[model samples]
Target: MKRRRVPALLLDAAAIVAALLDAWVHVDPDDRAAAACALLAAISLTLRRRLPLLTYVLALPAAFVTDAVFATLAALYTLSSLTRRRSLLVVCAAAFVTGDTASWSWPGPEFADLTDSGNLITVTYSLATAAAPVFLGQLVQARRELTVRIAEISKARESERQLLSDSAQAQERARLAREMHDVISHQVSLIAVRAGALQIGNRDPETKEAAATIRRLGVQTLDELRHMVGVLRASGSDPVELTPQPSLTDLPRLVDSSGIEVELHTDLPADLPAAVQRAVYRTVQEALTNVRKHAPGATATIGVHHTGGTLRTTVTNTARTRPALVLPGAHYGLIGLRQRAELLGGTLSAAATPDGGFSLRLELPVQDPG
Candidate 1:
């Protein structure tokens, strides 16, 4: 599978071959005995990845009786790499010592000094040689595990960065939506009301000139709205057009264009935060727009009062004698205006007044003098 596993496979194949050849040529006289030992060792090597302890058990007998050194080394490597049990390793070491002792004691060709206890030196040499394969396998296994852990950590960090990017984009989208709703809805409502008044008063030339000016203003507002929409759609690729934003100062112009005489009363402070001013402006604009659409030819009055570190605005309009044609209502503009107010820690309410009219009220906190 992996390139690293190829070397382990080659090593296992070589070990099996060496054990079979040694048994056949030097240790076992019978052909069947050597073949059986070779087959068992090969099978144990293959199963070592899944059952390391079992491989050690199968290789111990051949290692002790016939000096199958390759079989012993392969089993030891598999056991050390695949198993985490320390008790099992101690048991395997005991089995190896006992098997090698039994094989050395057996009467055979006395090539070395047997009486002088020099055989123990051979046994120690064989044990150390067998340990080499086990150490190599353990090192390889540890490196592979460390590589895998580092890769997982990198992936997790990448996922967190992507999530933060998505959250920032979503926040920007919501801000753009709120701005578009506040700007376009107020301007369009004023245009509609002024156009209706100009159509009704056809006898006066001055009224016609004023209506023409209102029409030009409406067109300019629409163009600005389109540019804002384009910038929002393109994201950072297009720069936002820095047109003048309507603050609380523009409230008088909004009332003038509504085609209804609005009696204004005020007690607002000299200066306020930019966000508070914009929020108050939009709240009044939305309320007056509702008044013009729902109640035609009615006298509307706006009241602004600053008290207890809060600015409060109220817009009330009387019902007309003749019922006006109600405009097609999408209802999202009011909800968005309310959300804008709440975002600035303010409150807004709209309801039918007791005096046969509609009333809209908004209250926003004002910063105290530094």
Candidate 2:
């Protein structure tokens, strides 16, 4: 029977009917003490499950003295079903059962005694009657425990499946990043190179401005592409081998091809790691391109300093003499530059100066720590 408020009441009704029947059929109406004892056991069965062993304690004497099988049987079943300790259930049930059937009036007491001859059938019959509820109750208890264990296993498996799915998505993202870098890096670089060449060939006020705008847009696009590639890599996607990135050696060509006036100063270490040189070149490229976009016809200064284990680079541009169209860049150039600097254990900063000019700075460690 289910343990619920309504079901408990219903169980009480069923027990009452069974108890009344057994009491009326087994106990003589003239026997007041026996009828009272049966009534007491029936009342105790009402809360047999609610009180645990307490109801069993009260029911035992009435069960052994009278023949109210319903109350005693229900009490025994509830105890066996609710109690967790196997040894306690076994001991209690055995004691209750032994006393319950000891005073039989059939064939009778002596012939059906525990060690009496031809008494095995009746003794076994009594044992079976007492054991039925306990057996069934234990069976239901085992089924409930099994159901709980199965549910736990199902939850664990589902969690494991979700983890695997997430891992797969991360790997896919990384692969996409790598492939993007491979496919777009060369084409974007070519656009920047062509724009820079055009700026050098045309020096007219409007032509120079247009050429610079083209170069600036190309570089900004490259910065966005790099940022996207970084995102893909972060997500765990692997890309194919890519073209070599620009480094310190490429800085002179980068500046000379820009077609804008620029002054350079350097004390950079002769032997610098490729990563540090790449970060320095990229930072300079981003700063110079930003100047071209925001302040066309501006003269810029590039500085590289080597001090012990750290390297510093700075790019500063004079106030604008020509204004270029302010193209909509998703603020990706600075983000790309920052990512590059951080990847090399370095920092990059860019800000407007008091003189209405712009300045960009990068600092990096000589050795790779990653």
Candidate 3:
């Protein structure tokens, strides 16, 4: 439950009332000097929050000449809460005890029997009374400081989390850009090579002109792709492996090393495009990775097929038999895979299955080289 704060004006009014009531109970109305001091002390509480030390000093005379001490204690507490000076607080509290323990007489204030049990008890009681407000004020100050520290810590944690998320996203974008360059450049190089061969071997002038045009354009596109790849590569510090990019042939090895029970099935043609094969491989890899991370001890089934001019890849996983362990992740696996598939003119979809399972599917158009 939240605590509501009291208004400073209301609190000050209440303190003045209590101080006036204390004065009425202890001091004789006919005592002009003591009555004036008590009235001044009670009214001084209005400045307690802003001018605590001054307020306490103004209230000290009343505590010495009369029994109206509430205003003095109130001022002491306010000063203690506002300041961090231990020596000053100690002096102020001792002054309050001294004034409160003295007895009022016609001439002036004087100390009673220091050896008597009653006087000793009076000194002890006065000391305890002064200490109470100081202690309470210090406790409130500590609590206010602790609340500020906790707020600072929470803000720092949020900033750290945002930085981590941004770093992860940047790294994932760079990786996808590199992979896209690899697939597009490979296919473009093949086009340039075949067009060059046609230009050299063809007999007709018109056919040679067309082949030369295609080869020239392909080479220009490849050069641009190379420049893009260079920029992507320079942005990261890690050494990149351009060769041995994942393909369908690596799926068997990937499944074996995935550390889970997985069934692999494929009816794909032997001559699928490198981009298509890579998309399938990456989709399956991300799916299997998700299963291992989010569904512990779940069995998965993978299917890849080429039918009716489309290559379809699907990975389905059963409900987990055990609870998944909590692990830290950059959370970019699925997002990167989706962008990879989109770059290759493919579509990827993932969703939870009806039986407390999961499924991810990818579909890419396949054009036969006649």
**C-alpha local distance difference test of each model:** 0.73, 0.78, 0.87
Considering only N, C-alpha and C atoms within 3 Å, which residue pairs clash in candidate 2? 174-236, 174-237, 174-238, 175-237, 175-238, 178-239
lDDT of 1 by residue, 1-370 (tens): 6898999788767776776776666565665664566557656777777877788778776665566556766787778877666567666765666565553444652343446567868767656665566667678678878899989999998988987886787578658856786766576767857765785677687677667657766766776776666556565454555456677788887777767779988877767888887877777778777776778778888998888888888888887656778689898877987898899898889888787898888888886655
Give candidate 2 regions above 4 Å deviation. 1-13, 104-112, 115-118, 203-214, 223-370
Write model 2 residue lDDT over 97-198, tens digit each, in one string: 666657645555423366765466656766787688788889888888989999999999998998899789888877887677777777878888987988
Over 199-224, each residue of candidate 3 has an lDDT whose tens digit, in order, gives 99999997897788778868867877
Better of 2 and 3 by lDDT: 3
The alpha-carbon lDDT assigned to residue 331 of candidate 2 equals: 83
Clashing pairs for predicted structure model 1, backbone only: none
Number of backbone collisions per candidate: 0, 6, 0
Q: After superposition, how far is residue 180 of candidate 2 from its true place, in Å?
A: 2.9
Please report how far candidate 1 places residue 176 from its true position, in Å: 13
Model 3 lDDT, full chain set = 0.87
Off by over 4 Å in 3: 1-6, 106-108, 183-370
- Largest TM-score belongs to which candidate? 2
* RMSD (Å) of each candidate, 1 decimal: 14.7, 13.3, 15.2
Structure candidate 3, residue pairs in collision: none
